[model samples]
Target: MTRTLVVVGHGMTGHRLAERLRALDTSGAWRIVVLAEEAHPAYDRIRLSSYLTGGSRQDLALAGRDFTEDPRVDLRLGCAVVSGDRAERTVRTADGEQLPYDALVLATGSEPFVPPVPGRDLANCFVYRTFDDLDAIRGAARRGRPCVVVGGGLLGLEAAHALRLLGMRPHVVESASHLMPTQLDAGAARVLHRSATGLGLRLHCGTAVASIEAGPDGAVRAVVLGDATVLESDLVVFAAGIRPRDELAAALGLERGERGGVLVDENCRTADEHIWAVGECAAVQGRCYGLVAPGYGMAETVAGRLAGRSPRPFDGTDTSTSLKLLGVHVATFGIIHPRGGPAAEAVFAEGTTRYAKVFLEPESGRLLGGILAGETGSRTALGPFVGHRPPADLEQLLLP
Candidate 1:
């Protein structure tokens, strides 16, 4: 008898779980039902900024024809699981259809965190997350006018770049001392700061938006800074951070992490044996990883376990990140910051255009973490050496 596997959420990780499960369960032991809240199937959210610069929705799609056409998979788009009865082993959709499952997986991902400043709900203020959000931003964006972006992290920088692509002047406001405060160190952020400024983007670090002031039409006219500075703006975008989407957990009486996410064990299994969770919605061992790589790893692990394979326990995942912001290459792997006492570090820089640093164990030459900014050509070569001893000639690896 084939078991029914109902997966709530069809983001990248959810799609990954379906793909992996189908491949592993070749015996047709399980039929998959994926319920997605969005009208469209899974798309590359990471490249969402490209849509403002001529990339189409099809270009960002992660699912292929083969996956969509699979007979054993029921892909229900625009169907949200409103609630569930854990005791009855079923979930009810928005349309009042109940789905029974032998096992259920929550891959609901995350939602963008919008700060609670006054006038944040104004017509022109938006949050950068979904394709629909981008569409709204593009419609509100005016060429040659100033746009303010809250947060200087990865998503914030991406939004600023999209505004620039639309011929709008972008000013990024960050409460931290520098950009990408969580990912890059001070020296690397300085290099990134130079690169962003070179691209004509304005930077306002160490300050927060006190409030958004509205125009006569009730849309955003300007933003007041914490230090009593006001920045005139045509629009505002909030990309501060993300919080896990674990709303369904509350109704099901499922435990959650302190910071918000479905609490799950190493195998991505919840307290109830019939339920499991992956991706941003899941807090594996009480930690939520917002990156796609770790989410993918968790998906694979759950798929393998469901397929009757003994998968390794997921203690943690590679937190490495590599991306291009305004044409500047940046990458961070392993531990970017040293904990406790100061650790030995190797540094290299080429004026203000490039910067690279690597942390190593004090006694042994084992690599701990690293950061590269500007031309990050060595990320691919240097990635494998993390947590292991790098080659003797470390200088060559840091060269731009």
Candidate 2:
């Protein structure tokens, strides 16, 4: 019997789920329909900031950009699934179209969080999320104009770098005591702050945005800090954080996490068997993953289940990240800071070239996790060592 599968959302995870299912389901027992809210099909959202530099919209495409050619696939771009009727096994679109499905998968992903502040709705104010948002910012940015980016996390720093690439001076405002406080410890954050400052980025750590002041024409003019200091700005970008898009899940009465995400089991299945959840929208064990790697893992898990194959249970993710942030090579994996415990620790720093730290089991010398900044050539050898014992000469192996 041929079954119908309706996938809600066409982001990277959604696209990945479709690809995985197609590759696994060689018997052709199921036909798939992908509903995407965005006008364009799925693209590499991780490189969204790259569009501001030299990368084009087409360069960020996931796969070959054409899934419609597949006989078993129905790709519907700019079509949003407005609601679900579980008993009827049907979903309604925003355009008042109804589609029936034997099974439904929710991969609605997440939305950018904008902090509520006065003048946040000003003309030149923006949130860094989509290509459209970047285009809007690019249109408003002028050479020598000053831009204020709220939040010093990865996205905020990316936005600052994008603005700098657009020929604008950027000021980063972070409420936390240090930049990337959640990702990096205080010591690493200090080093990052120095690197960012050397790159001509103005950093305002431990500062709160009291309000955004606009000009007479209602465009951004300045950002007022908690200490009454004003940062002159022609543009203001909010990259505070992200919140999962779980409105459909909420409306369907699905269990949710305390922090607002659709609750799912190890199989990525919701309370109802016919419906499954994955990606940022699905919160497994009461925790939602905001990173792409975990979301990709969830997508793969759900795809395996849909393929009717005995796949391994979804058991969380490593939460490790390796990327270049504003020309700085930064990599953090496992437990960078462990509570008082018996773990072998090694620290190596070579001036401005690199700062590397690794944690290992005391007796077995098994690698747990570590942090690498500046020169991360050691990441190649150290990354695979996670969860396994390194070579006996591990200390010499990490030399820059």
Candidate 3:
């Protein structure tokens, strides 16, 4: 008998789950129903900044008409699941339509985290997230005007570069001591800092935003820092962080992670047997992953289970990240900073235009993690050797 699979969100991970299940269910064992909150179909959110720089919406789209028009798939755009009756195996949408499902998967994804600073709600303040958010920012952007971006991480830097493309002077404010603190060490951050300044972007590190000061018109006028410095600006973009969109979990009475996500087992299954979760909204084994790769892994795991295939258990996948920010290459793999007092030893190298460091297992030279900045061509070769000993010609691999 064919079963109905109801998916709550149609973001990247949710879309992947449906695609994977469709590929595995060649016998037509399951019919998929995807309800997306956004009016548009799933798009490539990783390249969202490209939308600001001459890339059309079509360029960032992940799902085409072919996928959406699949006979076995029911794709409903602008439909949001408001509540669910777990015992009844049914979900209610915002439009008052009820959906019955043999199984349900939640992929609600995440939202931009805006700090609780005063005047943040004033006009000209934005958060870098969806296509709509980018549209709003572009509408408000003024050429040659100062735009302050709160958060010095990957997304923050990306937003800054986008603002630069819009001809605005971008200033980055990072609460952490260095940029990309979660991924890069002090040495690597210095290299990134030089690159950023070289591109005419201003940096304000190691300080928090005291508050967003509004002008007489109630729009952004200046940003006050915790150190008592004031930066005059007309626009502010908050890319501080992201919080999982698990608000519906409360209505459904599902358990949540300590940090705020639907708590799931290694298989991405919640306490309810019929319900599963994937993407940034799920906390597998008490931890939540914010990267796209881990979310994809979760989607694959759940898809395999639904397809009746015995897939690999989802303990956790590699959290390594390799990306180019503002034309500067940065990559971090495995464990850049291990816990418990730096048990691993690191081999460091520096050059005129690059910086590289590799952490070894201290005894057998097993690769623990590494950081690359400026010239990151070696990331592709070094990433696979994580947790294993690398090639004997390690010295040559570090060369720029």
Candidate 4:
């Protein structure tokens, strides 16, 4: 008997789920089809900034030409899921074709969130999310126009650095008191602030764009702030935040979370038996994990279970993360701030052009999680210690 596996959204989780399902179900001859909304093949979105700076286009692809050109898997590019019929077990594409599936998986991913503000519809405004977005940025940068990145978080900082690389003065506007507020402690944010400012990218902490007004012909000329001041700029990019893509899932009558994610069990199964969801689109136990690692874990678990292989339940995700921002390496795992009294303590080390900090629980002194900025050669060896339930004493790794 032949089984048809249709994966909507050919991003990281969708491609992974399809490949793993086929590998696990060796007995079932299966046909796989992947529909991607973007015209490009699955690429490394995490490194999009690198491409924005100077990285080659060919380097961004996670999957080579072989995968897209392969005959076994039908890769449908530039296709969007307009609708889905759960009762009929079929998905309608933007085109006239309605594809039938014995089993379905949705991994539509997310979109960059730009809040409603005055003059937002003006020209020279953009969001940093897709390859097309980066290409537009590249075109703007070649003309050496001053760039303003609205939002001082990870992606925003990266965009600022990329703009600086293109020989344009880049400014960052963060509504928070410091940069990387959600990821780094106050002190760590200060260190990053100094580092970024020293590199010539202006930092406006504790403030944001009140409005974006156009000049003579509807081209962005200045970013107006609430403080009654305007920052001169010709280009603006928004890396503010992202919201999960679950509009299609919601129309299917499947249970969804308040944050607009399809509610799924540990095994990534929705209300229907033959249906599953994974990646950023899934809300497991009323929570949506925006990270890639947890999304891949969900894909692995669901694929295993569908193939009649027993797998461990999908536990709630950890908030641990490690990444580089504007050439600064940072990593954190466990809880940086513990709940009880004196449970969390921060230990830090300083070197030439580098900073590292670890937060540990008092009694356990285990690695609750920490951040490394500037260089991360050591965190590769240090991650296992934090990965192992914070260890017995958090002070040991920092001191010895």
Q: Judged by lDDT against the true structure, how good is candidate 1?
A: 0.91
lDDT of each: 0.91, 0.85, 0.89, 0.78
Residue-wise lDDT of candidate 3 within 1-400, one digit each (tens)?
Answer: 9899999999999999999999999899999999999998899988999998779999988888878889999999999999999989999999899899999999999999999999899999999988889999999998999989999998999999999989999999999999988788778888889889999899999999999998999999999999999999989999999999998789799999999999999999999999999999999987888888889999999999999899998856457788888677888777766655564655555643677788877777788878888865567788788879877776577653
Off by over 4 Å in 4: 69-71, 142-144, 335-343, 349-366, 374-377, 387-396
User: TM-score of each candidate?
Assistant: 0.96, 0.93, 0.96, 0.90
Return the lDDT, model 4, position 140.
68
Top candidate on lDDT is: 1
The sequence of per-residue lDDT tens digits that candidate 1 reaches over residues 1-400 is: 9999999999999999999999999899999999999999999888899987789999999889898999999999999998999999999999999999999999999998888999999989999988898899999988999999999999999999889989999999999999999888888999889989999999999999999999999999999999899999999999999999999899789999988999999999999999999999999988998888889889999999999999887756457888888778899887765666677998888877889999888988789888999875568788788889888777777873
Q: Write model 4 residue lDDT over 60-164, tens digit each, in one string.
A: 776666666655578889998888888999989989699999888888888888979898889889999987898888886644566789999888998898888
Which RMSD values do the candidates have, in order? 1.6, 2.2, 1.6, 2.9
For candidate 2, write residues 1-400 as lDDT tens digits.
9999999999999999999999999999989999999998899988888898778999998857356689899999899988878888899999999899998999999998888888889999898888898888888999998899999999999989888888899999999999887677665676677788888899998988999998888889899999899999999999888899999986677889899888889888988999988898888878888888888888888888888888887866467788888667888887665546757877867665566778887877778888777755556677787889777766566654
The true-versus-predicted C-alpha distance at residue 302 of model 2, in Å, is 0.8
Q: Judged by lDDT against the true structure, how good is candidate 2?
A: 0.85
